[model samples]
Target chain A: MTALATGTGGVGSCFISQLTWLSKNLPSTRLSLCYISMIDKALYRPDYAEIDFDTALFTLEATGVEPPPISTIVEYLAAAPHNVILVDNTSAISLAEAYPAFLRRGISIITPNKKAFSGSYQLWQEIFSSATSGGSYFYHESSVGAGLPIISTLKDLVQTGDEITRIEGVFSGTMSHLFNKFAPTSGSGGKWSNIVREAKELGFTEPDPRDDLNGLDVARKLTILGRLAGLPIESPASFPVESLIPAALENVANADEFLRSLSKYDNEMEEKKLAAERSGKVVRFVGSVDMLGKKAKVGLEWVDQTNPIANLKGSDNIISFYTKRYGDMPLSIRGAGAGGPVTAMGVTGDLLKVLCQLR
Target chain B: MTALATGTGGVGSCFISQLTWLSKNLPSTRLSLCYISMIDKALYRPDYAEIDFDTALFTLEATGVEPPPISTIVEYLAAAPHNVILVDNTSAISLAEAYPAFLRRGISIITPNKKAFSGSYQLWQEIFSSATSGGSYFYHESSVGAGLPIISTLKDLVQTGDEITRIEGVFSGTMSHLFNKFAPTSGSGGKWSNIVREAKELGFTEPDPRDDLNGLDVARKLTILGRLAGLPIESPASFPVESLIPAALENVANADEFLRSLSKYDNEMEEKKLAAERSGKVVRFVGSVDMLGKKAKVGLEWVDQTNPIANLKGSDNIISFYTKRYGDMPLSIRGAGAGGPVTAMGVTGDLLKVLCQLR
Candidate 1:
């Protein structure tokens, strides 16, 4: 089963296109879209009929009914003829809370949604434990670093008995873009406030720039990775996350008002950038987990000019896994961390993995 | 079943240690060693029995008899009660040639051995086809880039219906070490002859350094990757590979004599380094596959001062995958790429993957 929105350029819509390609290319896979939904409407059959992957979006939009409650959907999936995989494309916390319900019903899950994994630690424990009891699988590779192989690589390293001492990287595409432009390695980049304004105009930032600046996105990623590395992180708020929003403007009534006053802090950011430059370094917003120290942090750091973090280009996310096997130098993976097609690729890849193991 | 030779400083020995660790940590995986062997000696029971992973090496040396022929071993593995996974630790072409025989009988294979995959195209085709016919699995992630996720990542990208346009990297760790010391990014590095001699003394090169200088290692890696990327590469020899070994020393009978005469080409290498320096670049030996153009090559290239390839440190390997989805920037994985622990880690990682799919 899969869910996608009808709007143009939506990740849900883009994911459906990739699923269509996958269904056509992998003929051996018995792919069937038995359920699909949006927030308000859904398209599914009482008889558990396979929805046409090619016209799923159009079909849902044309003739959809009110989405059933979580319990009803779980019951419907639990009674399917074959194994079922739930593709959660939306970032709905309510849907995320229903993950254990689906997994307990012997339904697997493949998703890019972070809330299911990065939410409260209690939910995290419940999800994995439920999957174990129900003999179901759950994969969320895109939750932390979008389409990059961060999650899988870490799992491999840990599984192979390699000790991961640390994991640090640029986890947020928005922060990566803002910092790369505001204090670039090659040149003195644009003013901080102007860069924020430009990034918002470019659609790189969240609808409200403060949403990205508050550092919750990066902290949430760190929280998920820390837990995966064997640390029972209570939540994203359990660690120290340096928010970029000034204390003075924490309660700005609107984004326009926030932007109007953001320039006032340009001198403060310029000072940090110049200080890093004076030390022959560049500034980058980064998140790191010291596994041995049992600590995770997200904030600005003065990275060396030649460091990979400083050399990031075009808002790419770079993660370095410092492990026992890959000694001295960490095993690093770098690329576009967010987007419709690539992120969808991660979900699709996980779905294939779950398919291979299903009876 | 598992097998490892008994010796100090042997990859087989290290692999057993890792396998022992894995068995202890991952209790769900029912790993057992039914056979153990060295080049001349082997140990096995008439009835397949689990050999203790911790003591397999010692037991093999203490009680092993003459190793049976390849066909006999295939029959032994095929007759096992449960599924069998053959981990080929040695880079023996004879063992590689028997892959089809084993796969044709439903025995999975996991290895860092490059010979089986990079050999004659016919053998590659036979191996894969035989695996398909017998319903067995084969994974050789360590064939290139050790345990740096090169093979798995490429497989993910291709499997997800992404278009791979190009693949380029410094593949051979020995070559990476020699070239980095010969033409460092930040300094006028040591003379090429001295660097090669130093690398040999440091145990970074093959017994006969010429084996590494012949450029065949990188070519073999490129062949495997190119074939995976959907090119019908005939063999490693089907493309241009510039050997770094000078013509005068090509026929040297021993490594000692070759080392004594290698100084004659120092000026030649120095000139090449100077040429690159004139353009404000550094020289590094690299392998590249133009997936779109259907070509593969291995040789030296002038890399930019700030390029990741130029900045590579130690004997690390770096691979960059340029694809349609990941536009402008390529997805790159970098790490140690060589060494017994990391390479064994790859084999172990592949074993876990096979374990997941086994009945």
Candidate 2:
């Protein structure tokens, strides 16, 4: 039995489309989508009847009932006739809090949610230990560098006994897009505030752009990767994260107000960009985990024009793993870091991994 | 039971060290090595006794017997009390030919050996079909990019229902080194022949450097990737490949003779580099499979100076996959594509994958 819980729009809808394709192509697996839900509504049967992936969204919109509590959902899935694999595509904190409870009842999970893994050290310990105690599988490949194989590659390096000395990358697509447009490698770019306003207009940033500028998204990604690379990172707040939001704008009434006033500090950003240009480099926002020093940091840095990070195009994310086996050169992966379809691909990929190991 | 068949030098010894590390850290899995063999000798017991990974190499040197025939070894592994995973680290065509026989007997296989998959299309079909027929597993993540997650990432993108349109890369590390040094992005470089000689002295090229200049290795890798992307590529030789070895020296008696006489034709390569430089581009040897057009080609190409392929350092490889979901920008991976330890890391990573699936 398979369950999908997602928000009504964005990646949730894209995941359902891919699920329809998988069900048709892999009929032998007899994969049945038994339950699906949005934040306020849910669709399922008491007998665990299969739900049609192609019509799941339409059905949920038409005849869905009130959603059950997290505990009730866990009980329903764990009591199914066959094995259960839950696909959590929502970033809801409450749902993330229920992961250990689900795992303790022998329900495997595949998710793209960061909160479940990067929220707190105790929660991280509980999630894995519960999976071990109940012999359940858990995978979150999309928690960092969505759909870029960053998490899995790092896991392989560590599991295969390669000593990873460092891991650094452009972990946030918003930051990447901002920097690439504001400080392109070969050309002078527009002012930083103008770029920020333009990015918001293009729907690249959150409704409240400060959420993206505060560096929490990048920090959450670094926390997930840092722990995976053998560092016991406490949380996203445990390290120094250089926020791009100006101090005066932190308490702005709204995003429009913030964007309107952002130009006042354009000179500061221009100075930083110009300084990097003078040294034959470009400014980029990056997150890094220094394993040897046991430190994780997220911020802006001057990157060589030839470095992969400086050369990143669009909003593509790039992660480089520096390990002993690979010597001086690090293993790196790059691509679109965020998009509804690609983010859902990571969720679907993790689901496939869980399915392969099932029975 | 686990068995390792290696060539006793280079990658074989590195794989042993990695295996030793895995056996210690993952002791809960109880993955015991039961057999080991080089080309000339073998070590094992009738009872499938555990061979200590830490001392297996020394033990084989001290007490080993003449290796048995391939058929006999397959039979012995099939009769073991537990499941078997055979690690093939040699690139011997003969042993690659025996892969189907081993899989048909219910023994899973993991390796970095390219011959097994790239040799013949018929063998490729037989290998997967036999594994399915015998209820066994088979994985070779290192076949395309050593320890870089290239094959796995491509498989994930395809399996999760993403439509792949193109696959392109500088696949060979030797080719990457030669071109990077011969046609640097920023400044004028030395002659192609001089760069080739330097690569050989640095141990970046094969003993006979022509083995790398021939372009067959890159073609083989392209063939494997193309097949995985759902193309029925017949074989590596079925496509066009541009060999760097000049026609006059194609049949040179020895590598030393070829190197001594290579400078005679430097003007031809110089012209190509100069032409590319005029267009603000650099020359790189690249292999590409255009899925939409159903074609795969390997040859020299002009790349933008800022392209990731043009900025590669040392002996590194870069692969880019263009797909429908990713839109105009392709997902790319870059790293050390060939090395003993990294290649062995891929082998060990595949072993871990297979182990997780074992009942």
Candidate 3:
């Protein structure tokens, strides 16, 4: 099968690199690039220098292709003799809206986009029904957790008589970083602020760290997870996000300013850490959805040291699905929750899953 | 899809129970018992009494027209209008020999039997070729690590850019039981006799505990794993079997006699355990295949307590596949290595995977 993949950012570059390598290695599958779009093309020229394959077949544009204006790409797909699978590596909101069109053309969409499912319940139902009716698959294994295979595991468990009662996890790399860096552990008061700065420098956090520090990114992931567990979840905005930045620091102009302002809140967090340590507990930012009692709001919780999430280090995201069959000890999945390579691998895995399902 | 499953003893009974319950609750798939063979039919009858499913189609005879022989089973499959995927849950080694014949008749085989792949390299090659030639699949995901999905993960990792350098794990549940129960703990002498007896009584170990304790069971699993990682491995018998029991214990006439003679070697193991602890390590009966210097040997390794396998508890097995792409921390798969239910679920998962591939 010939693939025409787009996007040229971090995820985009990783996908293209994998596809290019797979094209040479996998004899059965053939991949070809149809388009490459990014804010800057000069930066990626060195990365594409080794490619001996045809580049003229696709154009490298400066801006991303508009979702509604993908008719030309769709035409290229329809013209091909072999079946084509459309991979959406773009923003979630855009991909979600464009998914139905691809499904109409018998093109499967495998994405890391969390938006479509985490959107309104109507959109979620529409995407699923359209994909099923069109004899195609919509796979987003990378949406909730990166490269851990949580969705597939859950699917297998549910299909084989295991009933999941609660789905809980440290669903964010950003939050994991915050706790790992800031938590009191024989470190100075200013150590937390310095680590956050280093994280931003390493490109681990968003350009504006507020998107991560405010807990919006984690909330989106939790929303996606709840839907996968058969819950019609509310939007991420609806979840009560406990901000790491104090109200005084919220008005910072940028990441550097934000980091400088976060120092004031460190003492307050240290006190909480001390209290938790005295009680023989470690703090972890956790997201949980409990179905055993009355259907409740799925949101983040502060887990104790005894909890699996509390033990998670670095950027590791750990998920524990408590089920009737599994009893007290839930089926746990732990691994690198966020990274360019790992997240891209998650997307790649989801793409393969769709390809495997295609007849 | 409607499935007509045959047989109901040992692992077959577990599969039937799982399939029956899943089909009823989740009505996405329907299961019908086409045939059932049992030494004592009373066990299954009373257990299934409360379930109001039709049993008129089922048969009771152990070896009769009810459950047809291999040839007749293939014929029934060829004549059936709906696409039938043959799942062989029997221990008949001849089923491996007949796999090619079934594939030629357009029937896919999903079996937990290891005989086909582990018998001979040439025969294993022929079986694989025949399946591909006949445009069918022969998936045995449960053949290696029960419900752990080790084979599938290895396949995926190898399919990507990962070059497996070493494959290590506790591949035998019976061995895990022996090690956990008998391997000397803090200040206690090893209870070798009691561990062996308890393992047999609980059905965790094979009828012959020697097969597990002597490392033959682990060798078979490691051989399968080596093959999956693209290694041309020798048969299980070729690997050196390190017996936990002394030479004198091997000549014992009965289980009681063997138990009586186990105390002599208890002191030796206790000393070894203490020595390992002093060196900042734990003694785990580990099976590993390392290809560091153009030579590979599947043998025992004493891993440190910090290692994943060393921390494995109970019958839980943890596998680590070290590869170039994965770096130092290889992809780790940990779960219940042995159990009728988990093993049966592995077969069920393979069935679903094959179905997905077919679609």
Candidate 4:
């Protein structure tokens, strides 16, 4: 199978490493690196040569050509002698939109990009239909909870005719970290502003912390899950998403200005925390897709001390599927939801599954 | 593709129901149940023909012929024109021993039978090698944790080149229930004898509750996991297992006699629970595979309140995977580990994955 990779950032770099490992271990399947791209630059040959795993990135940086248009890349991959898998790790809206174009030409996709799945519902439909029409496949396990097995498990439940009544969890590692330190279940937590800043310094938050605080990331995840649960979710914006960005800072010129003014709103978050504590609960930034109710939401909720959601540690994500088959106690999965190696593991895992079918 | 099934017990009956639902919904895959069998009776046709899932169990009990030997069954399946998936939901040691024979004939197997996987190391190796040699497939997701994603998750971690350091969990639903009631983290619990009795009545334990108390069930689960994590686990008996069955009760005639004599050992368990309570911890039956140390064991452990194992509720099973990529926080999965519906869901889920390969 021919392989194409996009982006050379955190997850992309880790995926390349894992792909290298997989290529070595999987002797039955030969995965040749036929094409690779990073924003403006790309590396490929008309003959689809295998790239050296150790020096591919450095060589691409040194001697790569300017990347062609999305359609051109699709044409190249579609014409490959063997089946192709396009691994997209970047958060580029343009690239996410081009999924249908590539998939329609028989280029399978394995991605961690949430935008392709959680964007407008039309795009979601188109991507899948294109894969079907083209006799290709796509999997986005890392799109939701990174490497937490959330997507695959949900798919199994739904595919096996299990009625998923409710789906709930923390969907963002940054939000999980912020709220965990801000309103801990046991100890008295620090101020919300300080917690967010600490998460940023530790690289848990996006480059612009507001991007994490806006609740869009969590909303996007809920959209993907809600749709998978049989809800025709129009888009992430169609439902209520309680953004953490204070009104005054919502239009801040930059992340620095937003961070500097975030402390002024600490009193607001503190009040919510204290209110929850008075009722013997902790406030957590959580997302839920009510399949029975046909609703989806992402925001803060008062979680009981005994609830698994309240006891979550670090930046771990916990997802619970309340299916009819599973009964009262939901099937829950928890772990470090996001990381270079872990997210890449999800992509690699999906690749392995795809290889089984395509091989 | 053609399908065959064995066993018509709890999981088997439930599997038929799910398979019925799946066949109606999966328009692309025509899964024809060519044959099905229980221990005493069998149903099939010389030429592979689809059986009605709704009436299969009832029909088998009414007019089924006596089951042929394992080799004969394999020979019949191997002669079938189409690819075959053999769904074995039985605990028959004889059937477990025949996995290699079936796989070597290009007959794929999807099962929840722990005996097939956690048996002798040679059998484990043989089953896999036979699958490769015959170009067949097999998956045993329900072996460890019912419908939980334990096996699939571990495979992803290992296959993606993540170094798994340790795996620790409460593997048995019966044990989880017994300990959660007898030594709950935040509650004053009942006597071990009474807890065991309650669990038995609640359908949490095997018919012979002593079967659960013997700890071999948990040992078998640990063996499967240990081997998957790259250990050459000789067998479940190769590890040190702490059985809950008292020395005197070990020779009890039946479940009733065992339960009547169980109260005699209440003090033994009380002491262990008290010892844990003295340290502000709870004692729970648990299993662990230390990959780096190359050791595996199953026994009772004093767990701190913060540990997920201590706070487990009902019959939920929790597994934590500590891997090099995941770092300090282990990837953990928790939920209903056993039940007719859930266990069958695992088998059905595995069948779906195997279908992807075999189709």
Best by DockQ: 4
Ordered from best to worst lDDT, the candidate numbers read 4, 2, 1, 3
Residues A171-216, candidate 3: write the lDDT tens digits: 8877777676665233422356676777888888888777777766
Tens digit per residue, CA lDDT, model 4, B1-359: 65665578889999998988988898566787878888889998887777888899888889899998989899999998888888998889999999999999999999999998998999999999999899999999999899999999999999989999999999998899898899877768998888888888988889999889899999999999999999999999998999888898889789999999989888888999999999999999999999999999999999998899998898999999999999989999999999999999999999899888877
Cα-based lDDT at residue B167, candidate 2:
97
lDDT of 1 by residue, B1-359 (tens): 33322222366777888888988898788778887788888888878777788788788889989999989998888888778888888777999999999899998898888999999999999999999999989999999998889999999989889999999999999999998888988878998888888899999999999999999999999999999999999999999999999998999899999999999989999999999999999999989999888999999999998889998989989999999999989999998989889988888888888888884
Q: Which runs of model 2 end up more than 4 angstroms from their true locations?
A: A1-8, B1-7
Candidate 3 chain A — worst ten consecutive residues by lDDT sum?
A42-51
Q: Output the better candidate (1/4) by lDDT.
A: 4
- The better candidate by DockQ, 3 or 4, is 4
Q: For residues A167-191, write the lDDT of model 4, one tens digit per residue.
A: 9999888888888888887789998
Candidate 4: residue B70 Cα off by (Å): 1.2
Listed for each candidate, the true contacts retained, as a fraction, are: 0.81, 0.86, 0.18, 0.86
In terms of docking quality, model 3 is acceptable
Per-residue lDDT value at A63 in model 4: 87
Cα error, residue B135 of model 4, in Å, equals 0.5
TM per prediction: 0.97, 0.98, 0.86, 0.99
DockQ of every candidate: 0.83, 0.87, 0.33, 0.89
Q: Which runs in model 1 stand beyond 4 Å of their true positions?
A: A1-9, B1-9
Model 2 C-alpha lDDT per residue in residues B165-257, reported as the tens digit of each score = 999999999999899889999789898888888888989889999999999999999999999999999999999999999999999999999
